[model samples]
Target: MSSIGGFLAAGLIGAYKYRTRGTMSTSVFLMQLRVAAQGTVVGCLTIGLAYSMAKEYLFDKAPKENAKSLTN
Candidate 1:
């Protein structure tokens, strides 16, 4: 969910930049999309990593019972 949001935000920002730059060439469009995707992936991964670390160290201390949790 957050990854999708990051992609959307990146794409919107790229679109805004592209429009402001006034470059409508195919190459420029593709470049902008590539940059957005790369940025989104990196950002999503970083956030996921940080969240996982925080969950591991700063919050939960009990062993997970996946089966029990799934029935909830």
Candidate 2:
């Protein structure tokens, strides 16, 4: 998901920049690639952290709840 988001963002930004510059070159393409790579790393870390926190919050107490219900 993060990679997909980054790719889409990079494509949009690159296209806008290229259009404004009125030229397309290898350097521009490379720059966009770099941007996409960096974005992907950042996005993945952010999304992963959020997922971990959410999972912990949603399920961290399930075991204790189950144990209590069994005793009752």
Candidate 3:
């Protein structure tokens, strides 16, 4: 969640940078929005992948009782 917030902050800063430089027209804002959206999607995917990998590599061999915790 904090990482997502960081990405959002970076996007806002990027937009503000362009706006202050008089380079961010409406089209530029739209493009920035697209970039932010893509960042969010990528972030979510990365989190999912990391969680899966952590479970597989670090916890998959644990006892069945632990596995039940994972499922619920």
Candidate 4:
């Protein structure tokens, strides 16, 4: 999914460059690489954030009570 999105974004950028300058070349491929790198960084950051949030919300918090009460 991320690869697809990155390629789509890179293609858009390349198309824009072609539209303005009328050419696509190695530089455009390099631009695609840069875009893919950006996508990878964003994906890693998102995963890290979600993991941290889930840990904090679930494992790190105090336990909660159920509906039944325990009495002697």
Candidate 5:
């Protein structure tokens, strides 16, 4: 969700910049989209990996009783 938001924001910003410059091209727009897509993929992957690591670490260190409490 956040990655999508970031991508949209980037694209919008890029478009705005191009419009302000009074010169817009398909190539430039496509380039912005490509960059946005790459950023979204990297951001999502990084977030997923970080969340997984943190979850595993927390669960591993949690007491059995405390872990059981989560099921309730």
Candidate 6:
């Protein structure tokens, strides 16, 4: 999913940039795309990590209704 999203993002960036300035060559375009894709993937991982940490933190702060076991 991340890979697909990255590729899509890269493709969009390539099209947009190419149409705007027309200065970037094929190799530069390819590199830009690869960087864009990598950046997207890294961004996703960072977001996921932050989300997990926030959830864990919230859960830790939450109060327990009862500590006793059901059999008790």
Top candidate on TM-score is 6
Candidate 4 weakest ten by summed lDDT? 17-26
Per-candidate total of colliding backbone pairs: 0, 0, 0, 0, 0, 0
Candidate 1: where are CA atoms >4 Å away? 1-23, 62-72
- On a 0 to 1 TM-score scale, where does candidate 5 land against the true structure? 0.52
TM-score, one value per model: 0.54, 0.47, 0.50, 0.49, 0.52, 0.55
Superposed Cα RMSD, model 4: 6.7
What's the C-alpha lDDT at position 18 in model 2?
A: 66
Model 6 Cα lDDT, one tens digit per residue, 1-72: 967876787678778877775776878877876787688778989999999998888667877778877794
Q: Candidate 3, residue 40: CA error in Å? A: 1.0
Q: Sorted by TM-score, highest first, which candidate order results?
A: 6, 1, 5, 3, 4, 2
Total clashing pairs in model 4: 0
* TM-score for predicted model 4 compared with the true structure: 0.49
lDDT string for model 5 (21-69, tens) is 5566778767876887788788879999999998888657755663454
Q: Is candidate 1 or candidate 4 better by lDDT?
A: 1
- Give lDDT: candidate 3, residue 14: 70
lDDT of 4 by residue, 1-72 (tens): 976886798678766755666455768757775787688779978998999999989777776656566775
RMSD, every candidate, angstroms: 6.0, 5.5, 5.8, 6.7, 5.6, 4.5
Model 2: runs farther than 4 Å from truth? 1-23, 62-72
- Per-residue alpha-carbon lDDT of candidate 1 for residues 1-72, written as tens digits (9 for 90 to 100): 966776688778877877777647868787868976888678878998999999998899887776464454
State each model's CA lDDT, in order. 0.78, 0.76, 0.78, 0.75, 0.76, 0.78
Model 3 TM-score, 2 decimals: 0.50
State which candidate, 4 or 6, has the greater lDDT: 6
